[model samples]
Target: MTSLTTTQRQIVESDLGQCITHEKLLGEGWSNTVSCINNKWVARFPHTPESTQVAVEKQFLYAFGKGSPINLPNLKQTEGNYCLYPLLDGKRLNLEEAAKLSHQEKQKACHQLGEFLSWLHTSSFTDENLSTAPYGEADFYQDLWQYVAEALPCDLRLKAEAYLDSYFTTVPDEERKPVICHGDLGLNNILWDNSNAISSIIDFTDLFLCDPAYDFNAFYSYFGQKWVNMMSETYTPHIGDHFWQRVTFNKLRKALFVVYYARHFGYESYIPGRIESIKESLSQQLI
Candidate 1:
Protein backbone atom coordinates (compact mmCIF):
# COMPACT_ATOMS: atom_id res chain seq x y z
CA MET A 1 0.00 0.00 0.00
CA THR A 2 1.23 3.49 -0.81
CA SER A 3 1.61 5.65 2.25
CA LEU A 4 0.64 9.31 2.45
CA THR A 5 3.55 11.72 2.79
CA THR A 6 3.93 14.16 5.65
CA THR A 7 3.16 17.01 3.27
CA GLN A 8 -0.03 15.28 2.15
CA ARG A 9 -1.10 14.68 5.74
CA GLN A 10 -0.53 18.35 6.45
CA ILE A 11 -2.60 19.32 3.43
CA VAL A 12 -5.47 17.11 4.56
CA GLU A 13 -5.27 18.54 8.04
CA SER A 14 -5.18 22.08 6.69
CA ASP A 15 -8.20 21.42 4.52
CA LEU A 16 -10.24 19.79 7.29
CA GLY A 17 -9.18 22.47 9.80
CA GLN A 18 -8.25 19.74 12.32
CA CYS A 19 -5.83 16.84 12.87
CA ILE A 20 -6.80 13.54 11.32
CA THR A 21 -8.71 11.01 13.43
CA HIS A 22 -8.86 8.34 10.76
CA GLU A 23 -7.34 7.68 7.36
CA LYS A 24 -7.43 4.73 4.99
CA LEU A 25 -5.84 4.14 1.63
CA LEU A 26 -8.57 3.45 -0.89
CA GLY A 27 -6.43 2.84 -3.98
CA GLU A 28 -3.32 3.95 -5.79
CA GLY A 29 -3.64 4.07 -9.55
CA TRP A 30 -1.40 5.43 -12.31
CA SER A 31 -3.00 8.83 -11.98
CA ASN A 32 -3.73 9.42 -8.31
CA THR A 33 -3.25 8.14 -4.77
CA VAL A 34 -6.69 7.97 -3.18
CA SER A 35 -7.60 7.76 0.51
CA CYS A 36 -10.61 8.01 2.79
CA ILE A 37 -10.15 10.70 5.43
CA ASN A 38 -12.20 10.66 8.61
CA ASN A 39 -14.55 8.28 6.74
CA LYS A 40 -16.20 11.47 5.50
CA TRP A 41 -13.94 12.74 2.72
CA VAL A 42 -11.99 11.22 -0.16
CA ALA A 43 -8.59 12.69 -0.89
CA ARG A 44 -6.86 12.22 -4.24
CA PHE A 45 -3.25 13.14 -4.77
CA PRO A 46 -1.73 13.05 -8.23
CA HIS A 47 1.27 10.79 -8.65
CA THR A 48 3.00 13.23 -10.96
CA PRO A 49 3.82 16.59 -9.48
CA GLU A 50 3.10 18.26 -12.83
CA SER A 51 -0.28 16.57 -13.37
CA THR A 52 -3.28 18.84 -13.85
CA GLN A 53 -5.86 16.02 -13.88
CA VAL A 54 -6.99 16.92 -10.36
CA ALA A 55 -7.93 20.45 -11.35
CA VAL A 56 -9.48 19.32 -14.62
CA GLU A 57 -11.64 16.76 -12.84
CA LYS A 58 -12.73 19.38 -10.38
CA GLN A 59 -13.73 21.72 -13.23
CA PHE A 60 -15.66 19.04 -15.07
CA LEU A 61 -17.54 17.81 -11.99
CA TYR A 62 -18.67 21.30 -11.07
CA ALA A 63 -19.54 22.23 -14.64
CA PHE A 64 -21.53 19.28 -16.01
CA GLY A 65 -22.11 17.05 -13.00
CA LYS A 66 -24.81 19.09 -11.25
CA GLY A 67 -27.66 17.89 -13.49
CA SER A 68 -26.41 14.30 -13.77
CA PRO A 69 -28.84 11.48 -12.96
CA ILE A 70 -26.00 9.79 -11.07
CA ASN A 71 -24.04 11.32 -8.25
CA LEU A 72 -20.62 12.78 -9.07
CA PRO A 73 -17.80 13.83 -6.75
CA ASN A 74 -18.43 17.06 -4.91
CA LEU A 75 -14.99 18.61 -4.43
CA LYS A 76 -14.51 20.30 -1.07
CA GLN A 77 -10.99 21.62 -1.52
CA THR A 78 -8.11 21.57 -4.01
CA GLU A 79 -4.55 22.70 -3.38
CA GLY A 80 -1.16 21.96 -4.86
CA ASN A 81 -1.55 18.55 -6.56
CA TYR A 82 -4.37 17.15 -4.44
CA CYS A 83 -8.14 17.49 -4.22
CA LEU A 84 -10.66 16.46 -1.55
CA TYR A 85 -14.29 15.44 -1.87
CA PRO A 86 -16.88 13.75 0.30
CA LEU A 87 -16.64 9.97 0.21
CA LEU A 88 -19.55 8.42 -1.62
CA ASP A 89 -21.47 5.79 0.36
CA GLY A 90 -21.22 2.52 -1.50
CA LYS A 91 -18.93 -0.37 -2.32
CA ARG A 92 -17.36 -1.07 -5.70
CA LEU A 93 -19.66 -3.15 -7.92
CA ASN A 94 -17.11 -5.79 -8.92
CA LEU A 95 -17.74 -8.42 -11.61
CA GLU A 96 -18.58 -11.16 -9.09
CA GLU A 97 -21.32 -9.07 -7.46
CA ALA A 98 -22.61 -7.98 -10.86
CA ALA A 99 -22.86 -11.61 -12.01
CA LYS A 100 -25.00 -12.43 -8.97
CA LEU A 101 -27.67 -9.88 -9.91
CA SER A 102 -31.06 -11.23 -10.99
CA HIS A 103 -32.57 -10.31 -14.35
CA GLN A 104 -34.54 -7.47 -12.82
CA GLU A 105 -31.50 -6.22 -10.95
CA LYS A 106 -29.41 -6.38 -14.11
CA GLN A 107 -32.04 -4.43 -16.02
CA LYS A 108 -32.09 -1.74 -13.35
CA ALA A 109 -28.30 -1.48 -13.47
CA CYS A 110 -28.43 -1.18 -17.22
CA HIS A 111 -31.09 1.54 -17.03
CA GLN A 112 -29.14 3.68 -14.59
CA LEU A 113 -25.88 3.30 -16.56
CA GLY A 114 -27.59 3.95 -19.88
CA GLU A 115 -29.32 7.11 -18.64
CA PHE A 116 -26.09 8.45 -17.17
CA LEU A 117 -24.20 7.86 -20.42
CA SER A 118 -26.96 9.52 -22.45
CA TRP A 119 -26.79 12.63 -20.30
CA LEU A 120 -22.98 12.67 -20.47
CA HIS A 121 -22.72 12.19 -24.23
CA THR A 122 -25.36 14.86 -24.89
CA SER A 123 -23.77 17.48 -22.65
CA SER A 124 -22.48 20.43 -24.68
CA PHE A 125 -18.98 21.86 -24.53
CA THR A 126 -17.63 24.72 -26.67
CA ASP A 127 -13.92 24.42 -25.96
CA GLU A 128 -12.62 21.90 -28.45
CA ASN A 129 -9.14 22.21 -26.89
CA LEU A 130 -10.50 20.71 -23.71
CA SER A 131 -11.17 17.52 -25.65
CA THR A 132 -8.38 15.09 -26.60
CA ALA A 133 -8.20 12.29 -29.17
CA PRO A 134 -5.58 10.03 -27.61
CA TYR A 135 -7.16 6.73 -28.68
CA GLY A 136 -7.73 7.95 -32.21
CA GLU A 137 -4.03 8.36 -32.82
CA ALA A 138 -1.83 5.59 -34.16
CA ASP A 139 1.06 6.82 -32.03
CA PHE A 140 -0.92 6.04 -28.93
CA TYR A 141 -1.09 2.35 -29.84
CA GLN A 142 2.55 2.35 -30.84
CA ASP A 143 3.49 3.65 -27.42
CA LEU A 144 1.16 1.22 -25.69
CA TRP A 145 2.64 -1.68 -27.64
CA GLN A 146 6.12 -0.74 -26.51
CA TYR A 147 5.02 -1.03 -22.89
CA VAL A 148 2.86 -4.18 -23.23
CA ALA A 149 4.51 -6.39 -25.84
CA GLU A 150 7.26 -7.93 -23.72
CA ALA A 151 4.82 -8.78 -20.94
CA LEU A 152 2.59 -10.89 -23.23
CA PRO A 153 3.12 -14.61 -23.87
CA CYS A 154 4.75 -15.50 -27.22
CA ASP A 155 1.50 -16.77 -28.79
CA LEU A 156 -0.45 -13.75 -27.59
CA ARG A 157 2.27 -11.32 -28.64
CA LEU A 158 1.86 -12.12 -32.34
CA LYS A 159 -1.94 -11.61 -32.17
CA ALA A 160 -1.59 -8.44 -30.12
CA GLU A 161 0.87 -6.95 -32.60
CA ALA A 162 -1.36 -7.83 -35.53
CA TYR A 163 -4.34 -6.17 -33.87
CA LEU A 164 -2.38 -3.01 -33.21
CA ASP A 165 -1.18 -2.95 -36.80
CA SER A 166 -4.71 -3.35 -38.12
CA TYR A 167 -6.04 -0.68 -35.79
CA PHE A 168 -3.31 1.70 -36.92
CA THR A 169 -4.26 1.33 -40.57
CA THR A 170 -8.04 1.47 -40.04
CA VAL A 171 -9.62 4.85 -40.60
CA PRO A 172 -12.37 6.01 -38.28
CA ASP A 173 -15.68 7.26 -39.71
CA GLU A 174 -15.39 10.96 -40.49
CA GLU A 175 -19.06 11.54 -39.85
CA ARG A 176 -18.96 10.30 -36.26
CA LYS A 177 -19.16 13.14 -33.78
CA PRO A 178 -17.18 13.12 -30.56
CA VAL A 179 -18.87 13.29 -27.17
CA ILE A 180 -17.75 13.75 -23.59
CA CYS A 181 -16.94 10.23 -22.40
CA HIS A 182 -16.18 8.57 -19.10
CA GLY A 183 -12.93 7.29 -20.58
CA ASP A 184 -12.36 4.66 -17.87
CA LEU A 185 -15.83 3.21 -17.16
CA GLY A 186 -14.73 -0.19 -15.88
CA LEU A 187 -16.44 -1.97 -12.93
CA ASN A 188 -14.09 -0.49 -10.33
CA ASN A 189 -15.28 3.06 -10.93
CA ILE A 190 -18.97 2.29 -10.44
CA LEU A 191 -20.25 2.41 -6.85
CA TRP A 192 -23.22 0.19 -5.91
CA ASP A 193 -25.46 0.90 -2.97
CA ASN A 194 -27.03 -1.58 -0.50
CA SER A 195 -30.32 -1.02 -2.32
CA ASN A 196 -28.81 -2.76 -5.37
CA ALA A 197 -28.46 0.36 -7.48
CA ILE A 198 -25.55 2.29 -8.99
CA SER A 199 -24.93 4.99 -6.40
CA SER A 200 -22.22 7.04 -8.10
CA ILE A 201 -19.65 7.23 -10.87
CA ILE A 202 -16.17 8.18 -9.70
CA ASP A 203 -12.68 8.76 -11.14
CA PHE A 204 -12.95 11.13 -14.07
CA THR A 205 -9.18 11.24 -14.68
CA ASP A 206 -9.31 9.72 -18.16
CA LEU A 207 -12.38 11.75 -19.10
CA PHE A 208 -12.10 12.81 -22.72
CA LEU A 209 -13.95 13.35 -25.99
CA CYS A 210 -14.46 10.25 -28.10
CA ASP A 211 -17.00 8.11 -29.93
CA PRO A 212 -20.03 7.44 -27.75
CA ALA A 213 -19.54 3.75 -28.48
CA TYR A 214 -16.33 3.83 -26.45
CA ASP A 215 -18.46 4.30 -23.35
CA PHE A 216 -20.35 1.03 -23.98
CA ASN A 217 -17.23 -1.07 -24.58
CA ALA A 218 -16.62 -1.75 -20.87
CA PHE A 219 -20.23 -2.92 -20.43
CA TYR A 220 -19.92 -5.25 -23.40
CA SER A 221 -16.64 -6.58 -22.05
CA TYR A 222 -18.14 -7.07 -18.56
CA PHE A 223 -21.68 -8.36 -19.21
CA GLY A 224 -21.76 -9.42 -22.90
CA GLN A 225 -24.16 -8.49 -25.70
CA LYS A 226 -27.43 -9.04 -23.80
CA TRP A 227 -26.62 -6.46 -21.16
CA VAL A 228 -25.52 -3.95 -23.81
CA ASN A 229 -28.80 -4.51 -25.68
CA MET A 230 -30.75 -3.89 -22.49
CA MET A 231 -28.82 -0.68 -21.88
CA SER A 232 -29.27 0.43 -25.49
CA GLU A 233 -33.04 0.20 -25.11
CA THR A 234 -32.93 3.09 -22.66
CA TYR A 235 -30.21 5.17 -24.34
CA THR A 236 -31.87 8.03 -26.25
CA PRO A 237 -29.38 8.35 -29.10
CA HIS A 238 -29.70 6.51 -32.41
CA ILE A 239 -27.03 3.84 -32.76
CA GLY A 240 -24.72 4.57 -35.63
CA ASP A 241 -23.92 2.00 -38.33
CA HIS A 242 -20.39 1.48 -37.02
CA PHE A 243 -21.18 1.71 -33.30
CA TRP A 244 -20.72 -1.96 -32.45
CA GLN A 245 -17.62 -2.16 -34.62
CA ARG A 246 -15.97 0.54 -32.54
CA VAL A 247 -17.26 -1.04 -29.37
CA THR A 248 -15.65 -4.35 -30.35
CA PHE A 249 -12.35 -2.68 -31.09
CA ASN A 250 -12.44 -0.79 -27.81
CA LYS A 251 -13.12 -4.00 -25.89
CA LEU A 252 -10.14 -5.83 -27.38
CA ARG A 253 -7.88 -2.84 -26.92
CA LYS A 254 -8.85 -2.43 -23.28
CA ALA A 255 -8.34 -6.14 -22.56
CA LEU A 256 -4.78 -5.94 -23.84
CA PHE A 257 -4.15 -2.77 -21.84
CA VAL A 258 -5.37 -4.54 -18.73
CA VAL A 259 -2.64 -7.13 -19.18
CA TYR A 260 -0.03 -4.43 -19.36
CA TYR A 261 -1.44 -2.55 -16.38
CA ALA A 262 -1.59 -5.66 -14.23
CA ARG A 263 2.05 -6.51 -14.85
CA HIS A 264 3.24 -2.94 -14.34
CA PHE A 265 1.20 -2.25 -11.21
CA GLY A 266 1.95 -5.43 -9.22
CA TYR A 267 -1.55 -6.82 -9.79
CA GLU A 268 -0.27 -10.04 -11.33
CA SER A 269 -3.45 -11.88 -10.27
CA TYR A 270 -5.29 -9.95 -13.01
CA ILE A 271 -2.96 -11.22 -15.73
CA PRO A 272 -4.43 -14.71 -16.15
CA GLY A 273 -8.04 -13.53 -16.50
CA ARG A 274 -7.04 -10.73 -18.86
CA ILE A 275 -4.98 -13.14 -20.91
CA GLU A 276 -8.02 -15.38 -21.27
CA SER A 277 -10.12 -12.36 -22.23
CA ILE A 278 -7.51 -11.38 -24.82
CA LYS A 279 -7.54 -14.87 -26.32
CA GLU A 280 -11.33 -14.91 -26.51
CA SER A 281 -11.39 -11.47 -28.10
CA LEU A 282 -8.69 -12.32 -30.64
CA SER A 283 -10.51 -15.46 -31.73
CA GLN A 284 -13.45 -13.42 -32.99
CA GLN A 285 -13.42 -11.55 -36.28
CA LEU A 286 -13.39 -7.80 -35.95
CA ILE A 287 -16.74 -6.18 -36.75
Candidate 2:
Protein backbone atom coordinates (compact mmCIF):
# COMPACT_ATOMS: atom_id res chain seq x y z
CA MET A 1 0.00 0.00 0.00
CA THR A 2 1.07 3.58 -0.73
CA SER A 3 0.01 6.78 0.87
CA LEU A 4 -1.52 9.55 -1.18
CA THR A 5 -0.53 13.17 -0.85
CA THR A 6 -3.01 15.68 0.55
CA THR A 7 -3.64 17.08 -2.91
CA GLN A 8 -4.29 13.62 -4.40
CA ARG A 9 -6.74 12.79 -1.64
CA GLN A 10 -8.51 16.07 -2.20
CA ILE A 11 -8.70 15.46 -5.94
CA VAL A 12 -10.23 12.04 -5.43
CA GLU A 13 -12.72 13.37 -2.91
CA SER A 14 -13.81 16.22 -5.14
CA ASP A 15 -14.17 14.02 -8.24
CA LEU A 16 -16.09 11.24 -6.53
CA GLY A 17 -18.42 13.64 -4.69
CA GLN A 18 -17.64 11.79 -1.46
CA CYS A 19 -14.90 11.24 1.05
CA ILE A 20 -12.36 8.49 0.46
CA THR A 21 -12.80 6.01 3.30
CA HIS A 22 -10.42 3.45 1.86
CA GLU A 23 -7.73 4.02 -0.73
CA LYS A 24 -4.98 1.63 -1.78
CA LEU A 25 -2.15 2.27 -4.15
CA LEU A 26 -2.50 0.15 -7.26
CA GLY A 27 0.89 0.80 -8.83
CA GLU A 28 3.09 3.58 -10.13
CA GLY A 29 4.43 3.59 -13.69
CA TRP A 30 6.71 5.88 -15.64
CA SER A 31 3.92 8.33 -16.37
CA ASN A 32 1.07 7.89 -13.90
CA THR A 33 0.25 7.17 -10.27
CA VAL A 34 -2.65 4.72 -9.94
CA SER A 35 -4.78 4.02 -6.85
CA CYS A 36 -7.92 2.15 -6.06
CA ILE A 37 -10.63 4.07 -4.27
CA ASN A 38 -12.98 2.26 -1.87
CA ASN A 39 -12.36 -0.97 -3.85
CA LYS A 40 -14.66 0.23 -6.60
CA TRP A 41 -13.02 3.07 -8.51
CA VAL A 42 -9.52 3.40 -9.92
CA ALA A 43 -7.86 6.79 -10.14
CA ARG A 44 -4.87 7.73 -12.27
CA PHE A 45 -2.89 10.88 -11.66
CA PRO A 46 -0.16 11.99 -14.02
CA HIS A 47 3.36 12.46 -12.68
CA THR A 48 3.80 15.81 -14.42
CA PRO A 49 1.54 18.72 -15.25
CA GLU A 50 2.87 18.86 -18.82
CA SER A 51 1.76 15.31 -19.66
CA THR A 52 -1.10 14.83 -22.16
CA GLN A 53 -1.33 11.09 -21.39
CA VAL A 54 -4.39 11.49 -19.20
CA ALA A 55 -6.29 13.26 -21.96
CA VAL A 56 -5.04 11.01 -24.76
CA GLU A 57 -5.90 7.83 -22.84
CA LYS A 58 -9.33 9.20 -21.95
CA GLN A 59 -10.06 10.02 -25.57
CA PHE A 60 -8.87 6.64 -26.86
CA LEU A 61 -10.87 4.69 -24.30
CA TYR A 62 -14.05 6.69 -24.86
CA ALA A 63 -13.75 6.58 -28.64
CA PHE A 64 -12.55 3.04 -29.30
CA GLY A 65 -12.99 0.77 -26.28
CA LYS A 66 -16.77 0.50 -25.99
CA GLY A 67 -17.27 -2.53 -28.19
CA SER A 68 -14.01 -4.24 -27.36
CA PRO A 69 -14.23 -7.99 -26.80
CA ILE A 70 -12.10 -7.63 -23.71
CA ASN A 71 -13.01 -5.38 -20.79
CA LEU A 72 -11.38 -1.95 -20.98
CA PRO A 73 -11.31 0.82 -18.43
CA ASN A 74 -14.63 2.67 -18.40
CA LEU A 75 -13.49 6.10 -17.43
CA LYS A 76 -16.02 7.83 -15.18
CA GLN A 77 -14.40 11.22 -14.79
CA THR A 78 -11.47 13.18 -16.19
CA GLU A 79 -9.66 16.33 -15.16
CA GLY A 80 -6.41 17.95 -16.17
CA ASN A 81 -4.38 16.19 -13.48
CA TYR A 82 -6.26 12.96 -12.90
CA CYS A 83 -8.90 10.53 -14.19
CA LEU A 84 -11.15 7.94 -12.51
CA TYR A 85 -12.68 4.72 -13.80
CA PRO A 86 -14.53 1.72 -12.45
CA LEU A 87 -11.97 -0.78 -11.18
CA LEU A 88 -11.82 -3.75 -13.50
CA ASP A 89 -11.91 -6.85 -11.29
CA GLY A 90 -8.68 -8.87 -11.59
CA LYS A 91 -5.07 -9.21 -10.54
CA ARG A 92 -2.17 -8.32 -12.80
CA LEU A 93 -0.99 -11.42 -14.68
CA ASN A 94 2.68 -11.08 -13.86
CA LEU A 95 5.17 -13.83 -14.74
CA GLU A 96 4.95 -15.65 -11.41
CA GLU A 97 1.16 -15.68 -11.42
CA ALA A 98 1.08 -16.85 -15.02
CA ALA A 99 3.43 -19.70 -14.17
CA LYS A 100 0.83 -20.97 -11.69
CA LEU A 101 -1.75 -21.52 -14.43
CA SER A 102 -2.32 -25.01 -15.79
CA HIS A 103 -1.59 -25.82 -19.42
CA GLN A 104 -5.29 -25.78 -20.25
CA GLU A 105 -5.68 -22.41 -18.57
CA LYS A 106 -2.71 -21.05 -20.49
CA GLN A 107 -4.28 -22.15 -23.75
CA LYS A 108 -7.55 -20.39 -22.95
CA ALA A 109 -5.77 -17.22 -21.92
CA CYS A 110 -3.64 -17.22 -25.06
CA HIS A 111 -6.63 -17.75 -27.32
CA GLN A 112 -8.45 -14.85 -25.69
CA LEU A 113 -5.38 -12.65 -26.00
CA GLY A 114 -4.99 -13.67 -29.65
CA GLU A 115 -8.61 -12.80 -30.42
CA PHE A 116 -8.27 -9.45 -28.69
CA LEU A 117 -5.10 -8.60 -30.60
CA SER A 118 -6.73 -9.61 -33.87
CA TRP A 119 -9.64 -7.27 -33.14
CA LEU A 120 -7.36 -4.41 -32.13
CA HIS A 121 -4.95 -4.72 -35.07
CA THR A 122 -7.66 -5.14 -37.71
CA SER A 123 -9.85 -2.33 -36.36
CA SER A 124 -9.08 1.01 -38.02
CA PHE A 125 -8.17 4.23 -36.31
CA THR A 126 -7.37 7.04 -38.76
CA ASP A 127 -5.65 9.49 -36.45
CA GLU A 128 -2.43 10.67 -38.05
CA ASN A 129 -1.35 12.51 -34.91
CA LEU A 130 -1.15 9.20 -33.05
CA SER A 131 1.02 7.70 -35.78
CA THR A 132 4.61 6.99 -34.78
CA ALA A 133 7.56 5.06 -36.24
CA PRO A 134 8.43 1.56 -35.04
CA TYR A 135 10.82 1.35 -32.12
CA GLY A 136 13.02 -1.28 -33.77
CA GLU A 137 14.52 1.17 -36.29
CA ALA A 138 18.30 1.19 -36.71
CA ASP A 139 18.78 4.83 -35.73
CA PHE A 140 16.68 4.50 -32.58
CA TYR A 141 18.57 1.40 -31.44
CA GLN A 142 21.91 3.06 -32.22
CA ASP A 143 20.98 6.10 -30.19
CA LEU A 144 19.68 3.96 -27.34
CA TRP A 145 22.88 1.91 -27.29
CA GLN A 146 24.93 5.09 -27.15
CA TYR A 147 22.90 6.34 -24.20
CA VAL A 148 22.99 3.13 -22.13
CA ALA A 149 26.11 1.26 -23.17
CA GLU A 150 28.33 2.85 -20.53
CA ALA A 151 26.10 1.63 -17.70
CA LEU A 152 25.92 -1.98 -18.90
CA PRO A 153 28.41 -4.66 -17.80
CA CYS A 154 31.41 -5.17 -20.11
CA ASP A 155 30.38 -8.61 -21.44
CA LEU A 156 26.72 -7.59 -21.80
CA ARG A 157 27.70 -4.36 -23.54
CA LEU A 158 29.78 -6.21 -26.13
CA LYS A 159 26.99 -8.72 -26.74
CA ALA A 160 24.43 -5.90 -27.12
CA GLU A 161 26.57 -4.13 -29.71
CA ALA A 162 27.13 -7.37 -31.63
CA TYR A 163 23.40 -8.12 -31.56
CA LEU A 164 22.53 -4.63 -32.82
CA ASP A 165 25.12 -4.90 -35.60
CA SER A 166 23.68 -8.19 -36.75
CA TYR A 167 20.10 -6.90 -36.43
CA PHE A 168 20.67 -3.76 -38.55
CA THR A 169 22.52 -5.69 -41.26
CA THR A 170 19.83 -8.36 -41.67
CA VAL A 171 16.69 -6.46 -40.64
CA PRO A 172 14.21 -5.78 -43.43
CA ASP A 173 12.48 -2.52 -44.23
CA GLU A 174 8.93 -1.77 -43.09
CA GLU A 175 6.99 -4.15 -45.31
CA ARG A 176 3.74 -3.91 -43.33
CA LYS A 177 1.88 -0.67 -42.78
CA PRO A 178 1.63 0.54 -39.17
CA VAL A 179 -1.30 -0.30 -36.96
CA ILE A 180 -2.51 0.90 -33.54
CA CYS A 181 -0.56 -1.06 -30.91
CA HIS A 182 -0.94 -1.14 -27.13
CA GLY A 183 2.74 -0.06 -27.07
CA ASP A 184 3.49 -1.95 -23.82
CA LEU A 185 1.66 -5.27 -23.62
CA GLY A 186 3.73 -6.93 -20.94
CA LEU A 187 2.20 -9.22 -18.31
CA ASN A 188 2.01 -6.30 -15.93
CA ASN A 189 -0.62 -4.69 -18.17
CA ILE A 190 -2.72 -7.85 -18.54
CA LEU A 191 -5.28 -8.86 -15.91
CA TRP A 192 -6.36 -12.34 -14.83
CA ASP A 193 -9.75 -13.08 -13.29
CA ASN A 194 -10.57 -15.64 -10.55
CA SER A 195 -11.79 -17.99 -13.26
CA ASN A 196 -8.28 -18.09 -14.79
CA ALA A 197 -9.09 -15.98 -17.84
CA ILE A 198 -7.83 -12.64 -19.04
CA SER A 199 -10.21 -10.15 -17.47
CA SER A 200 -8.99 -7.00 -19.15
CA ILE A 201 -6.12 -5.16 -20.76
CA ILE A 202 -5.25 -1.95 -18.91
CA ASP A 203 -2.96 1.06 -19.14
CA PHE A 204 -3.36 2.58 -22.59
CA THR A 205 -0.91 5.42 -22.02
CA ASP A 206 1.59 4.06 -24.59
CA LEU A 207 -1.00 3.43 -27.33
CA PHE A 208 0.20 4.45 -30.80
CA LEU A 209 0.82 3.26 -34.36
CA CYS A 210 3.68 0.79 -34.93
CA ASP A 211 4.58 -2.56 -36.47
CA PRO A 212 2.28 -5.43 -35.47
CA ALA A 213 5.30 -7.49 -34.39
CA TYR A 214 6.10 -4.89 -31.74
CA ASP A 215 3.02 -5.98 -29.80
CA PHE A 216 4.23 -9.57 -29.43
CA ASN A 217 7.64 -8.76 -27.92
CA ALA A 218 6.40 -8.60 -24.34
CA PHE A 219 4.54 -11.89 -24.74
CA TYR A 220 7.60 -13.60 -26.12
CA SER A 221 9.82 -12.16 -23.40
CA TYR A 222 7.56 -13.32 -20.61
CA PHE A 223 6.26 -16.65 -21.93
CA GLY A 224 8.84 -17.78 -24.50
CA GLN A 225 8.57 -18.70 -28.21
CA LYS A 226 6.31 -21.72 -27.70
CA TRP A 227 3.69 -19.61 -25.89
CA VAL A 228 3.85 -16.91 -28.55
CA ASN A 229 3.31 -19.56 -31.21
CA MET A 230 0.14 -20.58 -29.36
CA MET A 231 -1.00 -16.96 -29.46
CA SER A 232 -0.32 -16.82 -33.21
CA GLU A 233 -2.73 -19.71 -33.77
CA THR A 234 -5.70 -17.32 -33.50
CA TYR A 235 -3.96 -14.08 -34.45
CA THR A 236 -5.45 -13.49 -37.95
CA PRO A 237 -3.08 -10.92 -39.47
CA HIS A 238 -0.61 -12.09 -42.09
CA ILE A 239 2.76 -12.75 -40.45
CA GLY A 240 5.56 -11.28 -42.51
CA ASP A 241 8.68 -13.36 -43.12
CA HIS A 242 10.64 -11.16 -40.76
CA PHE A 243 7.93 -10.94 -38.07
CA TRP A 244 9.58 -13.18 -35.46
CA GLN A 245 12.94 -11.53 -36.02
CA ARG A 246 11.42 -8.15 -35.31
CA VAL A 247 9.74 -9.52 -32.19
CA THR A 248 13.06 -10.81 -30.83
CA PHE A 249 14.71 -7.49 -31.59
CA ASN A 250 11.95 -5.54 -29.86
CA LYS A 251 12.26 -7.75 -26.76
CA LEU A 252 15.97 -7.08 -26.40
CA ARG A 253 15.55 -3.38 -27.14
CA LYS A 254 12.78 -3.03 -24.58
CA ALA A 255 14.90 -4.73 -21.90
CA LEU A 256 17.84 -2.41 -22.54
CA PHE A 257 15.63 0.68 -22.42
CA VAL A 258 14.05 -0.43 -19.18
CA VAL A 259 17.40 -1.15 -17.51
CA TYR A 260 18.93 2.21 -18.47
CA TYR A 261 15.87 4.36 -17.84
CA ALA A 262 15.08 2.63 -14.59
CA ARG A 263 18.48 3.67 -13.25
CA HIS A 264 18.26 7.16 -14.80
CA PHE A 265 14.82 7.71 -13.29
CA GLY A 266 15.93 6.39 -9.85
CA TYR A 267 13.81 3.28 -10.11
CA GLU A 268 16.63 1.06 -8.85
CA SER A 269 14.41 -1.95 -8.17
CA TYR A 270 13.62 -2.37 -11.88
CA ILE A 271 17.27 -2.49 -12.93
CA PRO A 272 18.37 -5.90 -11.64
CA GLY A 273 15.59 -7.87 -13.31
CA ARG A 274 16.10 -6.08 -16.61
CA ILE A 275 19.84 -6.64 -16.42
CA GLU A 276 19.24 -10.36 -15.93
CA SER A 277 16.86 -10.35 -18.90
CA ILE A 278 19.50 -8.71 -21.07
CA LYS A 279 22.03 -11.31 -19.97
CA GLU A 280 19.59 -14.14 -20.67
CA SER A 281 18.72 -12.82 -24.11
CA LEU A 282 22.40 -12.74 -25.04
CA SER A 283 23.21 -16.17 -23.59
CA GLN A 284 20.20 -17.81 -25.26
CA GLN A 285 21.01 -16.25 -28.62
CA LEU A 286 17.57 -14.62 -28.68
CA ILE A 287 18.74 -11.90 -31.07
| Best candidate (score: TM-score) | 2
Candidate 2 regions exceeding 4 Å error are 126-139, 151-162, 268-273
Candidate 1 per-residue lDDT over residues 1-287, each given as its tens digit: 43588889998888889887888899978667899888888888877666555566667787777789999888774566677888898888678889999899899989998899999888874343355543233345554455555655677677767766665457355524667888898788999888788899999876777778888898898788999988887898777666676787777656665666566556788777776656566656532
Off by over 4 Å in 1: 126-141, 145-172, 256-280, 284-287
| lDDT of prediction 2 | 0.76
**Which candidate comes out best when scored by lDDT?**
2
Query: How displaced is residue 12 in candidate 2, in Å?
Result: 2.6
> What are the RMSD figures for all models against the true structure?
3.9, 3.2
| TM-score for each candidate, following the candidate numbering | 0.82, 0.85
Instruction: Note the residue pairs that clash in candidate 2.
Output: none
As a TM-score, model 2 comes out at: 0.85
Minimal lDDT window, size 10, model 1: 128-137
Q: What residue pairs clash in candidate 1, if any at all? A: none
